[model samples]
Target: MSKITRIKGFADYFPPESEAFTFMENAARDVFSRYGYRELRTPVLEKTELFARSIGEETDVVKKEMYTFPDRKDRSLTLRPEATAGVMRSYIESGLATREPYSKLFTFGPMFRYERPQKGRMRQFHQINAECLGLTEPAVDAEVVAMLWQFLSSIRIPNLSLEINTLGCRECRPAYNEALKAYLDSVPEDGWCEDCLRRKSTNPLRVLDCKVPGCKALVDDAPALVDSVCEECSDHFGQVLAHLDAIEIPYTVNKRLVRGLDYYNRTTFEVTSGEIGSQSAVAGGGRYDGLIRDLGGPDQPGIGFACGMERLLLLLPEEEAPRPDAYLAILDEAGMARGFLILQAMRARGVIAEMSPTPKSVKAMMRQANRLRSRFCLLMGPDEIARDVVQVKNLDSGDQNDFSVTSESDLDALADFLR
Candidate 1:
């Protein structure tokens, strides 16, 4: 038998890393709230059709990356590859679409994708996703993007760049696909991967998302959707740009931008960082005009974005989240018992408390607490318990204070001594 380790492409965040991620999540949640977006939580697993219908069958996510499996009942289910589809499922199921014209919603949780292990990409990752349920206006799209920018700024993430574009509405999408396919067809099929060849038949635009060396060269001179956008799409995209400009949100027109999901209809954009490799996209979103009707809801337009927590952390300064300032050290069986009691009492009074299950020794616990950089050590022993007292030592000042132990009473004297 072999000792178990984490599967490739999956990661376990240790304490310090987990702390920093929590900070990032809290800031994202707070900023989402300020923008009038309330939270929505859904299950990590959903019916397989949810994603198969929402994310295009031709896309990488649906074709290869999704973690799908079966249950005891033999019904197929999948660990969500992303949030939008599941969120949409919740919206439709709850009948929230009929009550509100625009229901702003946000969700954060783990999303699973079965991709090869690599930098930036992972098998399991966390996303802070936000969705705007019913606004058809391009201003709504810009506002979401603005909120995303503000969130990154709030956390001091450096070198953020916004790449915006329009992928055309369903009414006019066929023509653009025709043109894109015409361009794709001009290139020899032998020069591309098998998936790209299949994409040529079902989803030609995904070839643009490919990093294949041969396909890259083939599409280098291909026609862009921006040049092919229909009149209504052109107007919609212009208004989105105008709204972004009016709000003074800096962005660049990336005519080549296209989302892997089939749901994106217009005004697609991705916020990227220069330093991160392969996973350069920190956040991305777009309009899904026909999605409501597609999901059997009344015709509702929507827009939103999802940010990767791990990738966002990469953009921040190297300084980690704040660690605990004090560790209450306990030694010996009697001292361990006393420490547990003290921890309960101190925690009730709003102190971050830590204690080992079994007391090692006074000197050992002191060293452990000091390595943790605890501000002070609360030392107790059989002798101290006998006198109904414990020693409070300030590691920094090398000063010690003694206090009687009791179930009720202010430890003001000990507090004053430490100070």
Candidate 2:
């Protein structure tokens, strides 16, 4: 028989690691809720066209990274590679825009993408996503950034930096696109990767986002989008920066920081930390005013961000193992019945308690108690039960004492002793 193993790019979180993830998630939820955002959940699968439509047909997410398949009845579906598209689809289908003027929503769960697994990336990844739909105010963008900043700070991630950029809207991006395309045409194709060559004719702006060194160097002299944005876009971006400044959020404007998505426009930002090596982008998002309308919804504007849980987990401080309040060790059949009663009573009092799964010698039980790091151990044997008493050992201080009880009925007395 062959041994079973986990699939590649997927992770298993055990004990203290799982506890650390829970702590981060709770912190995120607390921060998000404080700003009047409600939790929203959507299915992991959506129609194949949803991503293709929202994340640009030419982007890598749709071209090569999506996990798509045809379900029964010949309908094509894809496991969600990101949450923003699905959340927008739900907003449109649920007619949420009509019911409310603004929607502040958040969700956290698994997202699937078929990409070469690296140190902080996986086929199965999780994100804490926050979105504000039906609002076009620049202040909303600043608020989103502030909430995420507070969340990372609360979790104690070190050496943080925020990068901000603006991809001018459809109204002004064409001029920059033409200038960028001409520059791409001048560069010899021999130095470019196959993807960059294809993008030069297709979505040429994406060529700026390629990570290949030769490809990156070729675009070093390419045109900047900030210089090409129209007055309206420039003002909008200026207001976003102004708001960040008012709140004392430090940021650097990187001309080449194009996020790996097609829906972004006018204002894009990323939060990065040096702790994660190379892949330092811990959270990223921008305003997507056209995404709602493109997905067959109204012309509602939206702004949001998604933080990778796996990446943030890499920066979290190690957590200490939790200690149990008491361990019950029973010797002899008569003491077993009384042990059950005391265990229940201790638990009812909000004390963490456990018993050995099987009967064992005193030495073995003590070893188990030590391993559990239980504060105290309650021992019941034939002689102790006959005397209507139980021996309690303080595992931490190495102190021993005998406490009297009325056989199996003195739960109050046992609870008082443990407390």
Candidate 3:
């Protein structure tokens, strides 16, 4: 028989790496909660139409990356490639906007995308997502960006910077798109990548986001969308920048910072770090005032962002696995029975205690305890069990002490001392 292995692009997390993930999650909950953002968990699978509508059918995510398929009943379903669409679907289906005019939500979970795996990109990746719904004010955009900045800062990700741009709203975007399309059409087809060439017709703005060197160079002299935004969009963006300044959040206005999503409009922002190689963007998002309405929900406005958990992990320092506080060594049959009771007592009192299932020589048990990096080594034998006591060695300081276990109160005292 052959040994089974995990599917390619699907990663298995273990200690240290897993611990770093948890630390990032806990930091998200802490920072987001401070800004009145509550958690909302949605299923990883959803009707394929949800994404096709919310993320735009022409986007690369829908056209090439989604893990989409039909089920037994022949219904199209997809492993979500991103989170905002699902969150919007939930907000509409649950009618959450009706109850709370302003809904701030956050979620952390695995997201699937059928793309080539890289240092910080994977087929099955995780994201820490946040959404602020109902308010359309420029201040809302600024607040969302600020909250994201603070969360990333709290985790101490080094060498981070913020880049923001405005992709004019519907009323003004058509004119800029025409201008951008004209510029793209004039450029020789040989200068653009295949995707850029297709986008020149399907979605011209996406050409600015292409990572291909030829495409990037071609867009160097292209019309700047920010320069052509209508007064309303220009003012909205101005206010967003003003608010960010008021809060002391530094940002650079990147004319080409069009995020890889269709739902975004107006304010778009990204947080990047030099530490994560070519995939430098650790987090990004923007304002989507029309997403809710497009998803068959109320005319609610939303601003949110998502952190690629894998990318953020690349910036985090390696973490150590947790260690047991105490390891119990039972030297004989009698010690095994009494040692089990003591272990239970110690655990009941909130001590991180562990014991072997069966008895072993003291030398072997002590070696095991040292291997676990336990702070204390507890020893029990027939003599100690008969005397109603156990010896505890402080592994760190090389000190030893005996604690009486003749009564429950004594056990509590022993637990207190160990703790």
Candidate 2 has which clashing residue pairs, if any?
Answer: none
lDDT at 328, model 2:
91
Candidate 3, residue 376: CA error in Å? 0.4
Model 1, residue 369: distance off in Å is 2.0
Candidate 3: segments with Cα more than 4 A from true spot: none
- What's each prediction's TM-score? 0.90, 0.94, 0.98
Model 1: lowest-lDDT 10 consecutive positions: 410-419
Question: How many clashing pairs in candidate 3?
Answer: 0
Evaluate all candidate structures by whole-model CA lDDT and list the values in order. Answer: 0.83, 0.90, 0.92
lDDT of 2 at 19: 88
Single out the weakest 10-residue window by summed lDDT for candidate 3: 314-323
List per-candidate RMSD values in Å: 2.7, 2.2, 1.1
Tens digit of lDDT per residue, candidate 3, span 147-221?
A: 999999999899999999999999999999999999999999988889998999999989999998878888999
Best by lDDT: 3
